[model samples]
Target: MNRLDFLKHLGLLSAGAAILPTNFSSIKQSPFTELRGGIGMFSMQGGTIGWYTTDGAIVVIDSQFPDPAHAFVEGISAFGTGPQKVLFNSHHHGDHTGGNLVFENDGYTIIAQKNVPALQRTAAQNSDNEANQAYAATTFENEFSFDAGDETINAKYYGPAHTKGDSVIWFENANIAHMGDLVFNRLYPFIDRNGGAMISGWINLLETVAAKANSETLFIFGHGKPEFGVTGSREDLLHKRDFLSHLLEYTQKGIDAGRSREEITSRTSFDEFPEHISPSNFLSLPRNLDVAWLELTNS
Candidate 1:
C-alpha cells in the first residue's frame, strides 16, 4: 500500500486506547514552582521531561517513551484545565515521538521538524502497526512558531544532533528555550546515526544556541531538570562540546590502534567523563562512539 493509505489504515485504530504512562511522579510530587510566566516541568520515563506553559496550554517537548505519553497527559491534567494546543516532537525517536497518536486523537495538533514525518512514514510502513501509522501526520520540518498567552514559542530546526530532524523550541517572549533531545543537560548525548545525526554538527548547533542566549534565558532540556535564568550558560554548551570531542578523540584512538568494537566497549576511555557519562547517558555511548568512528574514518 502507499503512504497515504497506510496512514489512513493506521489512524483507524484506537488512538486514545494506545497511550501508556511513563513514570512522572517525581516531578509531579515536587512543588509546582513556576519557571517563568508559569512554565513547569513534568517528568516522564524516569528522566524524560516535558513542559507546561501558562494559559492552560501544554506543549510536551518529547512525549516520553511509549505508554508513558498517556500517563504524562493524565499527570498534567492536575496542573491546569486540560492539555490543549500543540505537542512538540523534538525528533522522530520512539522515546520522543511515540506519544504523537495519543495526543493527536485528543485534539492536540502535533508539530515536529519537516523530516520527522518522512522518518515516521518509513517507520510506519516497516512496523505496519496501528500506533506508528497514527503518528505519521504529526511531523514538520524547518521551524514553526505559535503564540500561547503572552509567550511566543519559536521552534527552529538546527541541523542534526540526536536525530536528523531534531529541532529546538525558543520561547522568545518568555525568554525560555526547549532544546528537545538536543540538550540532554549534563548527560552523554544520544546521536541517532540511522537518522543522519552528526556529532560535530550537533556540537556546532549547541554553540549556536549558546551564542543566542543571554543570562536571563531559561533552558528546558529534553532530559534533566530545568535550568532557570543564567543557569544554562555558554559553559554548559562547552561542557557538551568537550564531551563529544573527547569521545570522538578516544574512539578514534581505539580504532587507530586496531581495537575491535568489542575491545573499545570493554575499555574505559569514556569513564573519565563522569559528568556526562551517567547511567542514562551511558546507554547511548557505544552507539554514539560507533557513529563518531565512522564519521572520522570517512572524513
Candidate 2:
C-alpha cells in the first residue's frame, strides 16, 4: 500500500478526507497535521490531540484513546527517533486520558493539573477500570511551563469549566493553544457538573482566553460539530462563550418565572445554536438546560 493507503488503514484519514499540504512531507504519511512552527493536530476519536515535534523532543497535548494513541505513536515515528516524549492530559475525562496507559508503557512522562490524579483514580475506580488508567506523576496547580528545544510549552488552569482540572496547553513559539474540552466549538459540550463544571465559569474562561489571544493565534478545540471541525480562531472561542452565556441566561429566566424543570428542559433544541442540537439527545440542548438550571438554583 502507498503512504496515503497506510494512513487510511490506521483510521487517521477517512475514505473521502482531503490531505492538505504541509511543509513536512513526513506529516502527510500519517494523520498528524502540521499547523505551524512544528505544532500540529490529530483528531480521530474523543478529544483532539495537539503535538509538537522538534529535533530534541516530542510534546503531546491530549491522548484520545488507547487504539488511536497507539496509531498516533506509530504515525509520529516518521519524524525520526530518540526524541524525548511527553504527554499532557487536558483533564481527567476517560475520552481524553483513556490512552494514558498506552503512553505510559511507551516511556512517556504524563503531566496534568494537581487535581487530576485523584479525579482520574476515582473515575477509574467507579467504572472498575483502574488497571487501564495511567495517572500523571507530575502536576501543577495554576500554571506550568517548560522549554523543549526552540519551542516553549505552557499549561494553565483557570479553575472549573468543563471539569475542575481542565487545562489550556499553549505552544508559545507556535502561537497555538490547545483548549482541551473547554471550548467544544459548535458542539453541545459535556457539562461535567459532578466534576465541578459551571456554565458561568465556563463562559468567563472562554472570554478570558479569547481576549488574551491575538488575531494570528490558532486554537485547537477538544471537540466540534462536523461542519466546524476542531481547529479555529478566537472568534470560535467567543462563539462558544455566547452559547454558554445564553444557556445560563435562559435557564435563570426560567427559574425566576418558576418554570418546572421538565418545562424548562422540554425544548430539544435552541434556535440560536442549531448545530449543537444532537438528534439522539446525546449531549443535547435539554441536558445543557438541565445542568444550567441546577447551577443557577445552587442545587
Candidate-wise lDDT, in order? 0.63, 0.81
lDDT of 1: 0.63
| Candidate 1 structure quality by residue, lDDT tens digits, 1-299 | 76544432232221112232332233234423357665666543422455665666876666654466676666666666444657777777665666677777666777778788777667666667545434534555567887777777788988877778988787787677777667666555566676788888888888888889887877766553222211365567667777888877888889889988777655434666665433333345765677787777774
**Deviation from native of the Cα of residue 80 in model 1, angstroms:** 4.1
**What tens digits encode model 2's per-residue C-alpha lDDT throughout 49-91?**
9988888688888787787789888887776343588999999
Model 1 CA lDDT for position 217:
77
User: What's every prediction's RMSD, in angstroms?
Assistant: 9.5, 6.2
Candidate 1 clash pair list = 20-67, 20-68, 21-67, 21-68, 22-68, 113-140, 113-141, 114-140, 114-141
Q: Work out the TM-score per prediction.
A: 0.76, 0.88
